[model samples]
Structures are given as structure tokens and as C-alpha cells.
Target: MKKIIQNFGTIVLIFLSSFLFSQNTNSSFEIKNSSFLLNGKPFTIYSGEMHYPRVPQEYWKHRLQMMKAMGLNTVATYVFWNYHEESPGKWNFSGEKDLKKFIKTAQEVGLYVIIRPGPYVCAEWEFGGYPWWLQKNKNLEIRTDNKAFLDECEKYITQLTKQIVPLQIDHGGPIIMVQAENEFGSYVEQRKEISLEQHRKYSYKIKDMLLKHGITVPLFTSDSSFYFVGGSIKGALPTANGENNVDVLKKSVDEYHGGKGPYMVAEYYPGWLDHWAEPFVKVSTEDVVKQSEIYIKNGVSFNYYMIHGGTNFAFTSGANYDKNSDIQPDLTSYDYDAPISEAGWATPKYNALRNIFQKLNNNQLPEVSKPVKVISIPEFKITKTASLFDVIEGKKSIVNNQPVTFEDLNIGSGYILYRRIFEKDEKGKLEIKGLRDYATIYINKDFVGELNRINKKYDLDIEIKKGDQLDILVENMGRINYGSEINHNLKGIISPVKINESEISRNWQMFPLPFDEFLKHNFKTKNIPENVPVIQEAEFILDETGDTFLDTRNFGKGIVFINGKNLGRYWKVGPQQTLFVPGVWLKKGKNVIQIFEQLNSNETVKTIDHPILDQLNK
Candidate 1:
């Protein structure tokens, strides 16, 4: 009797083992008439979106594990062309920018991969993910079939595919799908001059280029219903975005694919993106759950736009403007109010989604990984200060007749100073032309007023003395990320400065502040004059290093640096009061913190374990 009982248990274990093996080894991926087929069996793709560059490289595996633990079988990501190729000839595929490593880690963490390699990925990124140098080509009409733009696109695709082709499902890897041109329909709608026919040809060319460079996975295009006509390729599977109605999505994709359907909502917004001065967005969890239930029950595949919204670290955040031309600049913290918070804590939505996904499988999901440790740094004071004026004092000035733009000066990111002396005692409407973003005005070291492109402040009245020096410090808040403004988005003083009727174009002392070079040269820390842009630094010792949020509540608008690595920008505004500091960038013994404060200095900094992303300015 004992032997019979043991034999029965052994047989039951073997049967379950065989079933799990079959599930793990399914390789062939196909887009069938009704649904996706894995090894000839219907498979439902449950995906979540998280960019590799946004999450620190060290935290990549943990985040992927979190995705899988939440019952997500697939991870969707975007490859920003600008992130890999900073300059035209220069390339960076190392460290956090390693595309191959990011993909392999996803596979290792038990998740299928879907990549969107966009030469233009409008992810609220700078220039919509196009390299800034692309604008330098005067003859090239971007997002079109022009030779210059096409050539660059081909080169980027060819180089990137070399790393991706080997990972496709056909090659026994986890990659199941690759996205073709990202939302061409949306671009065509924005720029009316560029016709649908032109973009259609461009989309076809891009699709062919992807195949020529060695992409074997099934290709898909994502756009809304109105854009499907112009944004889709004939051969690629059609997918909808931002559509909440599951029935509507099925109908639209069915029509696009000739009545047969494998529906997918490529970008379902779980939380809204926040811009400066606007209230922080907190999406309704009940609404998300309701829509998700509908998608699953009706055999629809959908991916959360951002399952884990990471930090934008550095000045990589972008801005937006609508037809009204009201510019809305994005905040640095991208804590998109996702189920997995910015610091990696699991929100209530995560548990809710997990419950829904678990109902589909008989076996329990993988256990959730423990949260990454967080440490709080004691408040520290900025001991040393140096004015920006003192740093650029001896740097060579480009004596240009007209104010040169950032692209014109060949400085990709940062601030530029435009100086002009009042030749004679005259006061009129002091104005600037082509104000790219934000600027601070000064008269002979005295603060004048501010010039903001978002509010469209063109000029201000001023009273001047004969020798009163005019200084305009312009900061590139961020480029206009989407819509019709791409072609005209250049930072710094773009055109000649004018005082009422007279255009001041001669001997305009234009100084491109080289903080790196100047800081290395001298940049002595001492007693600097107040009310000027100052460079301040402080150091704190950490016994252990983990993810922490830097509190910038007391300080004014400026950038934050952690141990020489840019942590991104901070403003006194309410929405984003803290900057995420990845533990990978900190050291155990000591860590250096620096700030280039443009306004009043608090001379103090603090670190909190959690993020404060939703608070509006009080």
C-alpha cells in the first residue's frame, strides 16, 4: 500500500514537470488570424513598458523580475537613437547604454521582449529622441524620404540590428516582436505640409530597411485609428494606442488587417505625464482595472505605457506645446505614478493587476522581489560658492553680429550668456528674438527681469545708463519634444537682440559657458557675490549605498550633480520636489553633491527614502 501511494505521487510530479517544460521551450512566434501563436498554440501576450535608459543598469534585473512577478510575461522597451548615438560620428553602447545587455537581462528574468527602435521615439525625450545634430542639416527635411534623413536612419537601423537580430525567437531567444516606425501617423497629422503620401513612402522605406538589416521577428505598427491610414505599413501588423474601448480597438485593427485580428493596445496610459506648473496626474486605479479586465476577457493584448516610471536623470527630459503654442515643460522626475513607484515600491495597482493575471494560470506566479534598500542622508550645507561670471571671466568670446543659437555655437546642452553694453542712455522696449526657452536678464550685475518662452515673454521695458551692461543668461529648459515645432526648436539667443527700433547686432559678447573646462582650469571656491548664479558643492559619507531621493524644496531652479554624475534638474515648483539619486552613482565612503543655483541659495540639502512627485507648488 505504501509503495502504491509513493508511485502515484511520483507520477503526478513527472506529469507537472513535463507540462512546465513544454511551456518554457515554445519558440516559434506567429501573428495568426485571431491571436498570436506560439509553436502553433494560441498565446496571450501580457506586456509592460519600461525603458532601459530610464532605469539604472544595476537595477535592470530587479525591475524585470518585478514585471514578471506582477504576472507580465513580456517587457516592451524603446531604443532612443539619440541615447546610443550622441553625435553623428560618435557612438556609446557601454554602461547603461548597452542595448544587448538590457535585452538579454529581460530574457533571463523570464520575460519576452518587444523592442521599438525609433529614430524618432516621442517618449517625452529631447528632440523626440533624434540626435540634436540632425537639425544642423539645412537641406534635410526630417521625418520624410529625403536622402540625408534616410541615410542617417538606415545607418542607425543597420547598426542597431546587428545587436538585435541574434535575439529573435527564431534564433531561440525571447524577442517576439519588433516595432517599425513609431507613430508616423501622429507626425503626419502634426506637420500638415508633409503629405500622407510622402510619409507612406517613408514608412515603407523604413520597413524595408529593417528587413534588409536582418530583422526576422514579426513587425508591428502602433497608432490611433485616425493615424492608421497614414502611419501603418502594408506588411506590418497594426496595433492601436490610447484606445480604452476594447471593442473599438478590435474593430479598427480588424479593418486595417482585412477583418482578421490580433489586437494590441501598444500604449495604454496608466498615469498621466506632468508638466511644470500643472497639477500632478494620478490616474484612477479602478478605471485602469476595469479597462484591463475588458482587454483580457475579450482576448485583447495590451501593455501599460509605463509599468515602472523611472527618473529622467540629467537634462534628458523634454517639453510640449499644443496648437495654442502654450509650452509645457516636463519635470525631471518621471515617477509616472505607475504601479511600481519610481523608487521601486509596489503600489496597490500592482497587486490588483497581479490578481487579474493570476486567474489565467493554474500555477502561482513568481514571488515578488524585495524592494531595493533606501538610505537617508543627513542634511548637508553647501560650503563653497563661485559665481558663474567668475568662471567665464577669461574664456574667449565669440564676437558675432547676431545672437547665435545653441546649435549655431556647437554646444549641445547647457546655458549660454549673451552680453551687450548700452552704448548711450536710452530706454525702450528691450526685447529678444527667437527665444528658444528660458532666460534671465541682468543689467550691470543687477537683476532685471525674466524671459520665459513657455509663457512667450518677448520683451520687457527697461531704463538703462550709458555703460549699463546687459546680460541675458538663457537656459535650455528642454526642446519642444513633439508636434510641428521640431524643425524650429533651437536653444539660446537665436537672432539679433533689439532695443525698440534699433537692432543690437554688433559686438554682442556671446560666451558659451564651459563649466567643465572652466572648473578644471581654476574655479576657486571662495566668497562670491550674492544674487549671481553660483556653483556650490558639499560632501557626505554613506555607510551603505541604495536608492534615495534628494530633497530640493528649499532651493530655487537649477541642476543637481551626485559625485560628478548629473542627477537632473530641480525647481521650487510643487509637482516634483525631489530628484531620484540611484544608489549605483553613490559611494560608501563619501559622495559629493553639487548644485548650480540660479536664484537664492538655501545652502542645504537632504535625502528622503521615498519620492514626492505629485505635490503642486504651494
Candidate 2:
């Protein structure tokens, strides 16, 4: 009889353990009494926004651990569509673009996930995160109820939901909320002719689309508090974005929700983004702590816009344009002066926030991870060189009467060269009506002058001899990621190349130098030309691998490729002088370094242990 009782007790214990495990994993998150309820209990979401594509895949866990250590219970990330679908019909989600792995990692680190999969994520990304191929369909208007655009968005969101649905909290995953559209309310003023009711209709369409595609989790819209009416949908919850203005934010939420409860700050800007020419933007630790305390005391949920702003690798950085059409391109490094630095190092801001959260939550914080080691490489000589002209000769040429933008050419990013022959000797005022960003004019293989869009310098005095080969190289610095001008950000010379206000209609041979294809060219080492853009190659030996910065202070504006991986662009124009080279991209022993210098070439580059991020050229 005693043996029978012992066996029954063992069985009961096993059953109870299994039941508790299942309950913990299958916890439901929902809205209850105007507050976020996790498993029927009120929960405060302390989230920090971070981009998975920006950080290396190997460091995802480290960054998430850092966020947890800083007292954040949740992570908010934006899914950049351009990063996933570079070209139409081509989808890549492996390596750095792996959103699934990122979410799973977050769950492992004990954090809930919030995804902002904006078919148009305006996180200062190129084309505002819209794939370049979308522009090919000239009739399809984006960010609206246009059938063509909606169809494409539907396909993308459908594919995305397939990956995310299984990971939602209801399905035993960590994802709690999925944002519908990003900051669409602030843009309503841009569409002056469109009524406020029309804006709400579009917002509703997106929310309905999310539901139709099997997104069971709650949908939310994030917008500035001032523009809540235009940005929010009827069914989806609305959240405000701001800093320290708790009263204004609370009032806005009450006005929208009709005095209901649970207030949330979707994007609390702890640090501001930096542009190429602008001063480095930083927020004091005291201010961040003050704002955070106010939110905590008021029982408000908030997420830092960028708790860790990583590198804008490749040509992914975006530009900004004002009402007057003034251009301000963002720097390569996204180090937004946040708690975590660009290379994932902790700063004073991190400590202050950690202290605040620990005191408020009364929970012991995790030990901070040790800083990653940085190594320095002695200067090495670049023995091999090839000119841009020689490289263009071997590429397939496209003939067009009038030049088209990069999208029309089926080229996504990098530089495009337009070559035309001047039949007769003439000196006239040459004007490129729609120069996208930057252009260099060459007459008879000689550098004549330069034109820039930032200062609106498009007119140039030129002298052309008979049969003089005219070459105008235009570099797509980056597309505007925000504001009203994003609708028409077509890179390259959009209009005809004009001389004396007359359109030059001649057979033009165009060469597309998209960086991915440009790197595959078999560059010649012997008899390289001078005074033009040249490709420089060097090999360095490393005893071990760690995160390091490639100092491009001596070199002119150009892109760096380490072992065929594009580290991103560097200019002498200040702000970002060094490019972060991840240890994963580096291997011990011999590693290849290639640079495509547009202006001046450097024989040697320093692989310094530290990054020179804020040093701007005077």
C-alpha cells in the first residue's frame, strides 16, 4: 500500500511540472482595461529599439544581453524591406537579415519583441526601406491605397507574417505587438489635397491587411502626439512619440482613447541621429534619466528609438531635405550617442539608465559584458591599381537617348557614368536639371569641374572641343529617407543633360557601376592610370581577429572592401573618419583589403584599435 502511494506521488509531481512549463511558454499578451496585460496581469513594456541588419549576426545575443542588463524587458526592431528584398523576386533572409534568429535570441535573453515591419521603414534607410524595383512601376504610388502598391505590399507582408506568426506570444513565441504603418500621420500635411478622412482610410486599410494575413497579435500605429488624429486607425491602438513631454503625451493619448487608461510612448528619443556635416548630437545622461523616471512614475511604457545605433554599412545611409530642397546626407556611422556605442560598447548613458531602472524595478541587473578588443594594423603598401575608365570599358553598356535614374536602369545603388561625344568645339553654360546628389564633369578625359545638389550648384561653364569625349559621373550618395521629398528621390541625372538651357539629345552610352558587380571585375595591376578614380589593393596579416576600425583619414572619398565585404563609404568631409570592420569579417593570417578611391588614392591605411567617429574635417 505504501509503495502504491509513492508511485502516485511521483506521477503527480511530473504532471504538475509539465503543466507549469507549458503555461509559462504559452502566456498570452493582450489589451485589458486600457492596459497591456500579460497572462491577465498588467505589464509595463520597457523596450529599446535596435536594427538587426545593422548589427552583425554573431553579436545579436551580446547586444540583447546588453539591453537586458540595462533593465529593458522588451526590444523593438524595424524590418527594413530593402535589406530583405534587394531586387524584385529576390528575397534574402540569411545571415544579418535573419529576423527569425533575432527574435528567438531575444526570447532566450528573456525579452518580449515588437516588430515594425514597415514596407516603408523610414529609419534613415535608403529609399525609406522601399525596394528600388518598386519605382520601376511608374504608375504605382507608394504609402497609399493604390491597388498596384497594395498588391506588392500584400505579398511582402504575407511572406513576413509566415515567419512571424509562429513566433507570436499566443503561439508560444515572444512577439507581442506588430506596428501597422510608421509615422503616417505626420505626412498627412504633405498630401494637402487629401482629406483627413482619406488618411484614416489608408491607415485602416493597412491594419485590415495585417489582420487578413493572420496577424493575431494586436496592431499599433506610432506617430507624433500632435498628429495622432491623422496617423491612427479605428481598430488599432495608437501610441505617441516624444521626449520628456509627459503631460502633452498623456493628454494626446487621452484625447485619442477618450480618457481610457494605459499610456505608451512608442518612440522615446534618447539620442538624435547625426548627418554628415552636422555636429554630433548627444543627450545628457541626467536628461534621459529624468525623462525615464517621469514615465516610470506615471506608469507609462516607453521604448528608446535607438538604444544601440550600429553602422550604416554599405550605401544604406540616407539623406534629409528641407522645404527649400537643401540636402543633408546622414553619416555612415549611426552612433546616435545612445547607451550603447556603434561598436557595442557601453557608455555613461548606459550606466545612468541601468541605475534608474534598477532602482525603480528593484531588481538586480546582469553583469555588463567586457568590451570587445580592437587591434591595430601597421600601414601596408597597395601594390596593385586600376583606373575607373579601364574598368568601365569591360562592362556592358546601355544606350539611351535620354538618361534615366538608377531605378529605370535596374541599378539599385552605387555610381553611374554617362558618356556623350561633343561634335563641335563650343564653350557654353552646361546645366544638369535634375542632378540627384553629386556629379563630376570630365572633358576629353580631363577633370573639368564638379556640381553638388546640397548647395544647388548645377550650372557649370565648360569648353568642349570637336569629338571631345564628355563623361559625367554621378554618385547616388543616398536617397532621402524622410519628409515630403521622399516621394521623388530618383538618383542619377533624372532629366536630360542640357547645355545653355537646351536639351542635348544624343546617343549616350551609360555604364552602371553597382558596387556588388563592381567588386567582381578582374582589375589589372600593371600600367594603371593616374588623376582619376582608381582601385587600390593591399594585403595585411593579422595574428588574431577582433573588432577594429579602418582609418580612412588619408584617403579621399571612397568605399572600402575587406575580403570582398563592403565596409561602407568614408569621406574627408568630416563626422565619420573611420569604418568599423567586424571581427567576423576578419580572419587570422592574410586578409585582402581593396579600396575604390573616387578622387585621391592612399598607399597605406591604418587599422587602428579605436574608431575616430566624431572627428569632422575642418
Candidate 3:
């Protein structure tokens, strides 16, 4: 009798273990009748969009929790190809670029994940997230069915799939949906030459490729409501992006989906992006609340385009061209005036959003996370400086008959110096025809003047003497991110620099000053004369470390680096006066700050606790 009782008890234990295992692992997500069904029930994806690369890895969990606290059950992210694969066949996914870790963290925070792995993500990113080497092919047409482009796209997608396929909902992970190529419909219209049929073929090709590579989750295409037809794929779900216009959005989706049912707004813009020399873009909290309420009432799922717009650190920011062919480079700080600011502080938008979402769900929202402390340090003095000329020695120099663009010289992002020696004295209007962006003229290592493309100022008054050297240091600023202009955004001197309508075609020396190379080399510890571009370094000791802003009021225009990590750029041009310096990059003992100033060579900078993000110069 004892043996039988023991055997029955063992059988009961085995049954219970199997039941729990199934309960923990079993998950079902599908799109039926237009509505998303999770665990065989309707689910509304109140989602927020944030990029892992934009936000620091240390703060990923914090951002995800904030999204959850705001009643967001889902998070949407774009996987940038160039960001992951900088070189051909070379990939880096560790650190902040870790996509798998990002998704896993979202799951840990109880937020579903929607992945938009774009071979091309036009997030105001340099080259639309395309690697600089793609232009090296010379004939590879991107965003199309070009064999070479598609071949490369397939390899990237396949490699990316291997990382996140296991994280799908069916595999007990949080990823619920995958997006087809981002907003291709908008691109189709932007480039009037591309036919609608071609766009459709390209869209389907990408979708088919994703499925071919073990992506079993539902696929969706997000496009502006006006361009839905151009971007939507036949087999994938179609979604729209807009602000507050639910009626038009519903009609557009219904028309595309054959009135079947489920509706979603993939990217609801709460705030707009800011460009250099432009006013900060913002939207009222009342409007956001009203629009969100409308969507919730209509059973519509929506995601904020940027719930937290982090910094566009380094040379990652791109530019846009207006109708008049004017270049507008995006500001480095991507603070988008979002609910969560650039420094991760919550705003009135956050409170309003939390209130609306909480009431809609009839559940008590989680308490907001405590704000991170910001510290203000005394003005640090720059003790060392290295002029541009001093650092150019022994650097790779390319000799050409005429000037070449950044791509032509096989360089990605940075300033390029073009040097030409004149045989005799020549004085006239030095016209740098087809100047891509900003140029600083120097005669025999002396500052002459500056020319900018925005004002169409390509001519500089010059007086060159015999045996004198003319050096034009041209900064790429940034490449045009959108429109047809992107195809021809060749940085540096595009055409020959002429003198009084005469093309000055002569032997030229080109020096590529990519920031990575600039930081790797050691600089001489000596002060250089002001007004010329130079690298400045300063060190400060901190008793305690916290987030702070480096004031650039005294400085002109330059990039800042803290402890070898790039904070971002700051300019005297107003709008963004301070760069956010996270305490994680700071040490308690001593911290190093480096600046590559383009104009003013101020050795001192103030460190403040609060950021001056929106103060515009009159």
C-alpha cells in the first residue's frame, strides 16, 4: 500500500510540472479581422517608439519602465543597418547597439516589442542609416529591386533575424510584429520617377525575404495616411501615421484593408524635429491628450513617434533640403520636446499622457521613477590645445587634379582640408562652385574668411601671393536625409574651386579628418592662436558624479567629447546652447573634456545642472 501511494504522488508531481511549463511558454499572437489577438484575445498596442542606439544601454530598462508607466504595453524600434554594420561583412551588436538585449529588456518590463529592421531607416540619420561604402559600388541603387542592393539587404536581414527570431512571442519572447521597409510609399512619391508597380514589387520582396529567414510573426507596413497605397504590401497589414485626425485615418485604413477591421497608427507625431537655425518644434499637451483619447475611444492602436528623443551624438545627424535647394542640417540634441526629455526627465506631457492612459485602462498607474540628479561643476579651464595644421602631419593625404567629395576620398563623416599652391599672385573673387556646405578659407595657414551654402555665399575675397598656399577646410555639416537631393549629397568640394570665373584646376592635397581618427591620435600640449579651428582639452575633478550640461556660450561651433565618449555638438547659433553629459561617462576622481572648436578657441566652459535647450538667439 505504501509503494502504490508513493507512485501516485510522483505521477501527480510530473503532471503539475508539465502544466506549469506549458502555461509559461505558450503564447499566441496573430492578426485576425484586422485586430491583433494575443493569447487568442484582442490586444491594443499602446506603443512608444525609441531607438536603442539613441538611448544609452545603462538606461534602457529605465526608459522601458517609463513607457510602461505611461500605459504603453508595446514599444517600437528601428534597427539601423549602418549603425550595426559599419563595414562590409563586419558587424557589431555589443554594447548600446545590442538589439537582442533591447528586446529582452522590453519583455522584462512587460512591454511587447515591434521590430522595424530597416536596411534604410530615415530617422534624420546620416545617409538614411546607409553605410558610406554603399556609394562605393557606384551603380547600386538603394530602396529598390536592384540585384546588388537586394543581395546586400538579404544578407543583413538574414544575419539580423538570427539574433531576434528566437525572441518572438511564439518562442516565449516579447516581439509581436515586424515592420516591412519603413515608409516606402512616401519615398515612391518623393522620387517621382519610381513607378508604383516597382515600389510594390520592392515592398513584397522585402516582406518575402523576412519570411524566408525564419520571421514567423505578423508583418506590417507603416506609411503616412496619404501615401498608404504606395507603401502597403499585399500580404502584410497596413497602418497609418498622423496626429488627431482619426476619421481620415480610419477611412484610409478601411479602404486599404477592405473594411475588415483592425486599425493602427504606427507613428503619431507629438513633436517635430529641429534643424540648425530653426525654431524648436513642439505640440501642446492638450492636443496630445485629445488625440490619444480619440484613438483609445475608437479602439485604435497607436505609437508615439518619439516618446523620448535622445541625442544625435557624433556625426549621425542628417540634413534636409528645402524647395529652394537650401541645406538644413539637423541639430545634435534630438530632444523632440517629448514626454521624456533628452536628459530623461518627465514633462507636463508625461503627466497628461499618464492620466489619460490610466483612466482608459481603469488601472492605477505605477509611480514615476525618481529623477536623476544633475550636478554643476566649476568652470573648467582648457590647459592644452592642438591646431588643425599640427594634427594633419603624417595623416593620409590624397593628391588629385581637382577636389573630391568625402565619398570620393573613401571617407565617411568629418572635415576635409583641400590645399592648393599658387605659382604667382592672383587676386579676384574666389568662387568655389558647387560648394556642398560650409568652408573656411585660409591663406598660408592664416584665416581669410568663411563661406556658407545656406546663403549662397561661395565667393570669398582673396589676395594670394607668389608661392602662397590656399587651404579650404570644408566641413560636410551633414548629408541631406530626404528627397531627391540625397542621391547627390556628395560632401566636400563637388566642383573645382575657381578664381574670378576661371576654374583653378591644380594638384590638390586632401586630408580626411574623421572624428574617430581625430580622437585616436595624441595631440601636442600647447596653446594655439584663436580664430583658427583647433582641438581643446580640459580636465576637472568631481567629488561626486551626476548628469550635467556643458555650456557652449563662450565657444562658437564644435563637437564635445567626455572621457573619450562623444556627447554631441554645440553652437553659438542658439536653440541648443548646452550638451547633456550623463554621469555614467563621468568619474568621481577626474574627468576629461575635449572640444574641436571650428571658430572661437575659448579654453573655458561652464558646467550647469540644467540644460538650456530652447534658448534661441535673436
Superposed on all Cα atoms, model 3 deviates from the true structure by an RMSD in Å of 6.2
TM-score of candidate 1 on Cα atoms, chains taken together: 0.94
Worst 10 residues of 2 by lDDT: 14-23
Predictions in order: lDDT: 0.82, 0.83, 0.83
Error of 2 at 161 (Å): 0.2
Task: Report the CA-based lDDT of candidate 1 relative to the real structure.
Answer: 0.82
Model 3, 252-311: lDDT tens digits are 878888786578999898888888767788899998888888899889999998998888
List the candidate numbers ranked by lDDT, top first.
Answer: 2, 3, 1
Model 2 spans > 4 angstroms off: 1-23, 517-530
How would you encode candidate 1's per-residue C-alpha lDDT over 32-108 as one tens digit per residue? 76779977899888899999888889999999989987888899999988888877777788898999899888887
Q: List TM-score per model, in order.
A: 0.94, 0.94, 0.94
The candidate 1 region of ten consecutive residues with least summed lDDT is 514-523
Q: Which residue pairs of candidate 1 clash?
A: 574-616, 574-617
**Which parts of model 1 are misplaced by more than 4 Å?**
1-26, 323-325, 514-518, 521-527
Models ranked on TM-score: 2, 1, 3
